[model samples]
Target: MRLSARLLLVCLPLFSLPGLAAPVADLYQVREPVASQQPEERDAALGRALETLIQRLTGKADAAQSPALAQLRKEPQQVVSKYGYEGDALLVEFDSISTERALRQADFALWGANRPAILAWWLNDGSEGSSLVGDGQSAAQVLRQAAQYRGLPLRLPLADLSEQLLATPENLLAGEPDALRSASERYAADAQLAVLARESDGQWQAEWRLWLGDEREQGKAQGANQAALADALLLAVSQRLAPRFVVTPGAATSLTLEIQGVDLKRYAELQRLLEPFAAQLSKVQGETLTFQVNASVEQLRAQLALAQLHEVTEQAPATESDAEAATDGEPGPRILPRTDVLRFRW
Candidate 1:
């Protein structure tokens, strides 16, 4: 039988009964040109900065005339905004900006940041789109939503969990029932998504698959020759995970994202699942996105305590006022930690 190798990353957080809800927050990393401003002017500066940023990123020769910009140019009555520093970049959030202009500005800004080849883009109102939109479940869905927010159309290449599972080594791979039941709970994935991808060598392909029940008969075993195994497995994966339509970009590129806000101990399995893609990844920033072991003094103290080491000096005290204080005069919602952490200095 031919040997076929496939690397899969499964992202599913642990779940509890109806009482506990899985935490949801936007996790992001954007390249820097950090914004600093006074309290009152901060909103306008950030908004203009984002608008200028969109123009820069999209490579639009005329910023004002662009359709996307036209939408954002007309300011909203209630422009909710927030901002903070994450490593090397400023993380900002804008809510209820009236039209799609704010999104347009941000999208173009990300486009300008990444440039001509967009990694991915999607916009979903949860129900109107695939499971990848609102309350997006799978890794692919999350990636798609991120891309959409940036106005890029980079799609994932794998979708069918069963096909992905079966393609791996016998010991590493699980079957339908266990794979679906276990992976669903583990990865926070719904039953549907679409994926498009480009190989490391610059070949574009698409695939998609839905979650089918495990009770059905296991597909017949195949013992293919060495050369055929790769082709066979690729076909299967593509059939199950391909997008409804595929678009070929002039350039080959992919986006690297780092998430925070996750409990490192609780997500070890997901981290392991993501390891394979990490290895195959050619274009990446920094090292693996590990937990922020020492973001604050308290975190450092916690680590020291866990190591059972004696404190060298008395720890500095932090106050409830400081904890509750808004980052940059914005609301507290902007302070949410990144869920999937990356070490990007950008």
Candidate 2:
């Protein structure tokens, strides 16, 4: 547990992870509310919990029904490392390596653990009255649990007077993110989600919008109550965000990445982000580092975006006229651009 691993050079002999700032600490663990601990009920809850785990990993709502998982579906207990009951909840932990290997063998694209954190600002309207859901409020607990079930790292605003003023019904359901974005600056979240829900005749319905970088995803969900509505909405969000980061196993390109401004915190964050890429530190030069990794270009960039790393675009080669002009003088050694090597700066 030494914090000083020489700028994480030792990296715990394959990067032993400390509890990180982002990335859910337990991606493979699921806590599903159970009706009872009876054999039949416990068995059913474990199946549902496995389904939730698969949905969280593949970002596909129907992944549990895949033919490749038929064996696991039949024998879900085979992958369950441990299970226990806590009050009315059933906690199940699945074997991570087995789950990922099974999914990868089935040609499923898997999202890494270093997922983005969503800052949610929600407003609730009931027949009696309306109120903004704050981080310290009891109502926020359901949202937190639902986010955990969906494997999303959710953040709630303090809901102070200023935030309460900003959480009007119109603003929460607005298509634009300007006001919410301005209010969310202090949170440093990777995405902004504004939701408005209303309960009528004991049924809950919700409308939500999510802004992740330049991409926008919006959806509507309904449930018998508030907690169901929260789960329904977060399932949609997880599915929408998964495609942006899922790395298919087809390509195993041996790529090199050069990152500048390597420090303690940055190294820790980089280790998590590059985990799926199978990254290895190759060399270090002052504040910069070079790593050899195996990953696809498209998905790699998407993962690095979570760290706010800027890609260094290589300059265009000189045109024919400029090339002829340069020929007049002694040409220096040409360094060819490498498509496999990506460059980024913090």
Candidate 3:
């Protein structure tokens, strides 16, 4: 049976509460343009592959036909393909219990025991090959490792300005909406990130213009261009939104969060030290604070252990999809279908 595929957009949480216990936000920097990959096709392929695997596992070709398996079977294509492009490699593939995996790999996963069931099938294939070529992390592991996505920056389509302005910086200073719009469209990306800076008499002004696509919204705010100010506004806007984000554990059943102690001074110190964790926090009363305090303690110990376990580095690890497995095996180039899982385009 053919598995239908669609683009799945998972907008992870923007701001985590201040004093978060563990580094909950997984940060990802896109080094490649993720526009051309086709997740729908990938999902469809994944669905078909799983269906075949299940049949191989239980000796049932119609295993996917079961009503309980309907969702996975229907959207298999949307479930597997993720932010892939030509010449890119898969560094990690985590199979978590949540649908968020679909958005991260730019692909999808069949929830419940389905993950293990699929894995079972993959193992049984005995083809001496791994069906999913990620770094061997489960779906849940991958999701937990991914950083939260900051909200999209504004995108503007500027009209072509008169050619006279292109000749000189002085004329360029006399800005035009069309020119600015073009600039926004050019640098503004699928993630809606923009860069606008202005200089006035030794002062550097960085401006971030947010475009609201809703029809009822109009007008914009222009604040003095200070990096701090720009950063604050961007943080405020991005952090204010609650992304439809959830973490799926690597195993079945709820994951236990064991909180150990309550220490405000320690919490405060940890907060300052862990500022680079790509999350925000707010003051919560009583036990919440205590819980986080202990969590941070555990986290610090873990980080120390991890650092001891590996080489020190100034950069984060690279993220990739399971497709990286196909790289050396196939000498020829391959083409994958493209699908827009989420629309942030202005």
TM-score of each: 0.25, 0.89, 0.20
Candidate lDDT (C-alpha), each: 0.31, 0.85, 0.28
lDDT of 1 by residue, 1-346 (tens): 1111111123233431211111122312222234454444544545554553343333343444566555455552234355666654455554423223454444432121111111111111122223222223344444443333333333332335443443322212233334334434433332222222212222322232323221121221111321222233222432232221111222212323332222323234323323312323232122233332212232222222221223333234555555676545744433433333332211
Please state the error at residue 66 of candidate 3 in Å.
46
Worst 10 residues of 1 by lDDT: 113-122
Residue 253 lDDT (model 2):
84
Error of 3 at 70 (Å): 44
- For candidate 1, give the lDDT of residue 164: 49
Among the numbered candidates, top lDDT falls to 2
Model 2, span 47-142: residue lDDT tens: 999999999999999999999899988888988999999999999999998888888888898887788888998888998688888899999999
lDDT of 3 by residue, 32-81 (tens): 22323476544444554445333322223354577766666675543333
lDDT of 1: 0.31
- Leading candidate by TM-score: 2
Off by over 4 Å in 1: 1-24, 27-71, 74-80, 84-88, 97-188, 194-205, 210-346
Q: Which stretches of candidate 2 lie over 4 Å from their true place?
A: 1-21, 316-321, 325-336
The predicted structure with the larger lDDT, 1 or 2, is: 2
What pairs collide in candidate 2?
none
